[model samples]
Target: MIYQTAESINDGRAFLKIDEFIKNNSVYVKIENMNPGGSIKIKTAIALVDAAEKNLDLKNKKHVIESSSGNLGIALSIICAARKYNFTCIVDKNTLPHTIKVMKAYGAEVIIIETPHPERGYLGARLDYIKKRLVSDNSLVWTNQYESSANREAHARLTARELLNEFPVIDYLFIAAGTTGTLMGCVQTVTEATPATKIIAVDTKGSVIFGTPSAPRYIPGMGASVLPPLFDSKNLFDMVQVSEKETVQTCRLFARRYGFLVGGSTGTVLTAIRDYSPKIPAGSVVVMISPDGGERYIDTIYSDEWCLQKGLLQLQSSTSRNTFSGAVVE
Candidate 1:
């Protein structure tokens, strides 16, 4: 059954299911999808724009420009549309179709850049181009999501506060590291409230986050080739590197088991949880953050044929039937 409930940003009671998961295992999981924008980026988007407005004279600003993989762009587009500010997003060539459509629907101009390398895909190049353009046009406000302190602050204030209130006794948190804002925010909050709580950061195998080799990542939101300035690795107790295959399998499992169609990064978190579960003391708790929903990846990870073509699904010789190796478990 689809768990339908009115979403609330301020209500701690609404997150009881997540809290129960934390309590049962001895850890707390904070689902930031409850944010108004359908992802944790909503917190960052609000803070980024608000900070820009406060720092710069916005009375006659012409446009707000930013480079993003998907969610952050969508959030910024919505904020700009509602505030009547012209917004422009420079996204990678491979950005999801639905994400592009949603940004356009919000009256934001979308610029898709074909990145030189198929792997890096315009995140850095597009930002460099935008910065150059901003130099010429002083009216444009550049909201650099990766290096933005406001993004980190949003997670620290809103997401962290909600988690602490919902699971006061949380002992460990497993988070997929993207731009590092969410993890950094959680780290800051947990350090202040529950000093003993341990934070485990998860990254993809190909991501250069922990000085790993750079490889193309199928998963869009999490993992970065370059260490994001916002990531304070010292605060994290440990880090786990999840493979793309594991991420895809976990996402499918979450859908089948809990009826939660989460995205790739969420799958990585789940994989880490399973890998680390046995080591956790029996009475201790563990919580993982699922960053976004799976509707955006309908033609990709959520599709069986797509899975087969990607080698994420294989045929069993005995039965002559295709089956996924990673079965769903609640």
Candidate 2:
């Protein structure tokens, strides 16, 4: 077990079969949390940097900036730290505290946006800040995950290939969409290779990614108040929007049942799978991506006190193992 570089250590990640969880569906989860960045976003971080270098942008630019909820910020922080570039991550108030700490620990200047727009929400506020800052400071290069083709292309080239190679003939792929980079990347790959494989794009209830109304979305990894440029509705097989409550319940259920502390996005996908099991045919090879583990979410998604403060305590009493119906919470 020897490694050359810590920044680009994202290949052949472990994936496992959890077929017993859902009946009639051979459920499989790719454990992407094993990466050095502790999330599936490591691929995109590398790709974005590589693309920048290829275009000769990174040669003169020493400072890199991006607006991320949590995972991608940390990913870029790791890369920027390794490359000796000054990294500034503009995140909103909803991002997990541990996530902010991780980004900061990786030598990133973390900027927290405490306000949200009337309709656009914190995402819009973050974007506005980036735009204004970029206008003022010419040295800062905004990664623009929402609009960056590299964000989508990176997933298409790396993650999509990883998924297709692991499960060459999967019946369905469930992906939680934030910027829609991951989901669209798999969509592009599967559409070109296995057209029969359905792409189930999972979004949170408060997200506007799937025509859902925008609101205060606390969970970081999934859901977007603004529609991402990478999102394409043409090839989507279906859409499942899970609530914050359902996400908390499913995460707790996994922690209780399998002793695996999954993050909020993974919980949302699992909740979607549980609620959408009826749509999947019997014995279907259902594959999903677990973007990150639960360590970084220790404050919010994994804390009962935080949940109580956020008014999500109903999950412990209302949700059961058998019933995880996706109800609107925010």
Candidate 3:
């Protein structure tokens, strides 16, 4: 298989018209899942590492550590392996089994935090562990994806440029918010390049990013118990929150209609698009950024047993699917 350099993987991805899934002719989906690391997190991961190298933060540090649910951890693992640096990923229990295995396969040490923070839950606990480790180990460097400026910089410099190049006249840009890196980065770039374009931030209902109450969440890539530093509401054109059940339903719809299996976060984006479609003007171009594919979620979002256990099995209804229709833009 042909591959781009880790530093330039952003060049390898392209937008695919998932109009059939959107049931709208003008909407387009950028499948960031095609990134070698399996998610858009690869962009920020490379940016963070590059920044560290430039700042001499990794001068004497042979060990790199970061707190992540999945995607970022795997991205770092891949980068560390290619750069000949040791990597340690501190993850919460909600992280999928396959994600940990992938990180390990790339020569990363995985640390699972069993306990959840009383207020912030798993994310807090994971961050707390990294802080403690950082104090004791002078050689351990943390990427700090949550608060790192480089996180947002990567998306602005790489991702946003790609989107604008593909569709220079975007009317709406729909993005899922995680650590707010992707959201903030793209917003910064898009708002400046296409001032008339609307940028919608799609977050999970239980996420605290938009000042919502935090709850136990099973989905990995998006939604955070604590507010991310990069999140800036003033820049967003609008915000939409989708329930986990709705997210799963959308994922199921994509699987049945498009033969595509997208992650929980991508499902959230799709759900937002459907809910917000009526308000969107006709003939306007809409672009949704899908962070990753659903392959890693086969045990969770795509599993019948898992859905049943979570009381989400009944959410799979075909009635809602009947309301939609489109054609692929070949």
Q: What is the C-alpha lDDT of each candidate?
A: 0.74, 0.83, 0.83
Where model 3 places Cα greater than 4 Å from the true spot, the runs are: 1-7, 20-24, 315-330
State the lDDT of candidate 1 residue by residue for 44-140, as single tens digits. 7778887778776554695799988888898888778767789999887657888999999889899887764455444567766787888999989
Off by over 4 Å in 1: 1-28, 117-121, 308-312, 315-330
**What residue pairs clash in candidate 3, if any at all?**
none
TM-score of each: 0.87, 0.92, 0.92
lDDT per residue for candidate 2 within 47-135, as digits (tens), equals 77766666647758888988998899998998888788899999988888888888999899999999898879999999999999989
Q: Per-residue lDDT for 1-330 in model 3, tens only?
A: 222234457673567777654444556888888787889888888888877776747856767899999999999998888888899999988899999999999999999999999998899899899899989988898878998899998889888988988888999899999999999999999999989999999999789999989976888889999899889999899999998878877787787778888899988998899889888877789888888999889889878678767765563224443332221111
Against the correct fold, how does model 1 do in TM-score? 0.87
Clashes of 3: 0
Best by lDDT: 3
Query: Which residue pairs show collisions in model 2?
Result: none
Error of 1 at 235 (Å): 1.1
